[model samples]
Target: MSAQITLNARNLSRRLGRREVIRNISLQLKRGEVLGLLGPNGAGKSTTMQLLSGVLIPHAGQIEICGINLAQEPGRAKACIGYLPEHPPLYRDMRVDDFLLYAAKLHGVARSGLAEALAIAKSRCGLEDTGRKIIGTLSKGYQQRVGIAQAIIHNPDVVILDEPTVGLDPSQIRDIRALIRELGNAHSVILSTHLLGEVENICDRVEIMQRGQLIYGDTSVRMQSLGHQAGFIVTLQSPPEPAELYKVPGVVNVEALSATRFKILHSIDANTAEALLSLSAQQGWQAQQLTPLQGNLEDAFVHITQKQPNQHDQT
Candidate 1:
């Protein structure tokens, strides 16, 4: 693989006992990019995360982390990865500093560099003042920070986080997201989430999985733009009946908001918009305003996934 690619997987597939939970998933994470693994619950997102983090082996396909083949050189490849699972692994009884120290050593940090590594991890996660305190005594937000600190203590080339902010309050979610954005400034990040907001706020690119298969992949901006293809909204000074509006070509549904305003839904064709403009001008329905609706992520997600075959036998 190229040096700029921190992670590269080719045709990865894995089965749990008798059922195939992941199928032919290939993805890449470039240096300094944040990638989102987006899907609904039970869509095999977490399983894919586990496979990418080297916690579970793929039955078919090659994984290269920092150019080292995971199957041939696991130690070197795993050393280049830092992963935070959906559930944060913590020994609540241990003090914050003690837990992180153990984590750094476990990741193979040398004795001479352990102190520096610990300091940097603590600082990055904003845990400088919580070191002396017991981990269990800290709030959920701080505990999550501790979890992140452990992952990045060794400064891995790629960071993988699964549902990192599943249960935090709004403020805590904001803080964690900010920390994640800061991490993306330097490290390649893969975040698995069912939450659309997390994908919108943190991801540069997105790959959507459903029914053990990848359904869509693209830049976040383009994925979001899919929802806008439905139609536009308009306001007229003298509105016509719903039946009259429906008579226009390509117009599918017209939802009246007020006497003069309506939301328009139509087929994916520019002719629909042109017909509306021409009709409005001819009828002297003084077109007061016409605006496109902001795209809906859920709509785009559903639209992309609706065609997949039903294969819910495995999760």
Candidate 2:
């Protein structure tokens, strides 16, 4: 069976003051999946998050949370969502336990269910030991944990976190990422951040925005595979002339990198590896390494976001 979709936004557009900030953005999140919203500063990633979480209504488009239309029934739609903004809604003077209880009440957790909800939220967020501590006295990491705990206090179906690890150190970031991964097992997560590494480590799928437009969206595996499909690096015990390698089917260009190593560029639909291996056997060229050039997420992000909108559409 297919996974259930917990959040959906279609043709979402938003404008701030006189400038259009989001343009025809559309995305979906499935239960048990983590979807990262990535973009540079001012790319509208945060804006998109606000739209999805019902914090900011869209100028044009529709949003649904667990099949409830956000525009038509905002309270019901929002009841299914938990949101943690970039700056967590934390009150420094309040005790962790008190703040969480307040949050639980605000989310409409029934009086009868508050105790159980608080316990579950605290346990899931690793706050079982710090409930008595004041929020201001805790480390940045713990503060973030408390922030997350409150968001999930009501056990919403979708969790939206915007820059959840912004000020965290390396260790804290790792812990938070692990927590996010764990959250994905039970909730659809939308992580909005400019940090590429965060997306690579925590997201099952990624959507990249540029100047308020979605430039690319795909599963993390497929996005990374795009680089390998573009070219290959071949090493042979006895080098063949570049022209001979280029003669292989679908091979567009071949460049000799060293005495025995060559780089081959190929057409999009070509299986360069298979063709090269066959040619190596036929020509008696002993193959040492036949590796596809794999592209990292950073490279893919740069290449896609750097293109002009019109140019991108043409390709």
Candidate 3:
């Protein structure tokens, strides 16, 4: 069975002041999937999040939330989305319980259901015991938890988080990451951040934006494949000339790093280790170490964003 699509955007474009900030970006989010929006500063990641959450109207585009058209029925469409901006909307003077109760009401939760909604939000955000505490008295990490609590208070079908871990310490970042992973189990999540490592750790799929446009969008599996296909590092007791190693089947190119170390570039279908071992025995080049060189998300990000627009789209 196909997964249910909770959020969809097509031809989304936006102009801030005199310059166009986002151009013709299209994306989809399915139920239970965590989609990461990655880019450098001024890449329009924040603007895209605002558009998707109905916080900013697009100059030209269509947004649907849980099948409701945002332009035609903004109230219904926004009802299905929970948004936490870079600086979360929180009332520092109010108690955690009071703030969440207000947020629940603002989202249209009936008076009768407010208690249940508040409980659920607090429990999910690890704020259950701190309900009576003032928002200002909470630590930065707890404050972030409160921010997330308010967003999910209404139990929306989709959640959009912008730079959720910014200004956080190492421990706080780990805690928040765990919460984000937990949120993905029940709702479609859109995470926007300039941090590439976060995307590598938490996202199932990633879309890279560059100079106001989406340059690449693919599953994490496909992104990792880019790195794995780069090549392998092989060490031998007796290093042969680069040409000798290139003679092996499936070997594309060889660069000698030292008398005993060489970098071997090979086809994706090549069993590089097995071929190297077989050839080494025959040539008296005792193999010492043969390891696949893994590629990282940073490499893929650089490769996509550094290219010109006319070069590629949606790889």
Name the best candidate (by TM-score): 1
Give one digit per residue, the lDDT tens place, for model 1 in 209-290.
9867787899998999985667778998998778989999988889998888999988876477778888989998888788
Cα shift from native, residue 187, model 2 (Å): 1.4
| Tens digit per residue, CA lDDT, model 3, 1-315 | 888999999999999888999999999999999999988998899999999998899999999998999999999888888999989888999999999999988888889999999999988888879999999999888998899988888999999999999989998898888889889989999999888889888999999888889988898768866646557888898877777888888888888888888888888877877878988999899898887888888777776676645475544
Task: Tell me the number of clashing residue pairs for each predicted model.
Answer: 0, 0, 0
Q: Is candidate 1 or 2 superior in TM-score?
A: 1
Off by over 4 Å in 2: 237-263, 267-286, 312-315
- What is the alpha-carbon lDDT of model 1 when measured against the actual structure? 0.89
- Tens digits of per-residue lDDT, candidate 2, 1-315, equal 999999989999998888999999999889999999988999998889889989899999999899999999998888888999888999999999999999988888899999999999999888999999999999999999999998899999999999999999999899899999999999999999888788889899999888898988998877766544478888999877777887888888888889898888899898778988988888889998977777788777776777656686798
- Winner on lDDT between 2 and 3 is 2
Q: What's the TM for model 1? A: 0.90
Q: Which stretches of candidate 1 lie over 4 Å from their true place?
A: 1-3, 247-249, 271-284, 310-315
CA error at residue 156 for candidate 2, angstroms: 0.2
Compared with the true structure, model 2 gives a TM-score of 0.84
The deviation in Å at residue 11 for candidate 3 is 1.2
- Model 2: lDDT of residue 102: 97
Give me the displacement of residue 178 in model 3, in angstroms.
2.0
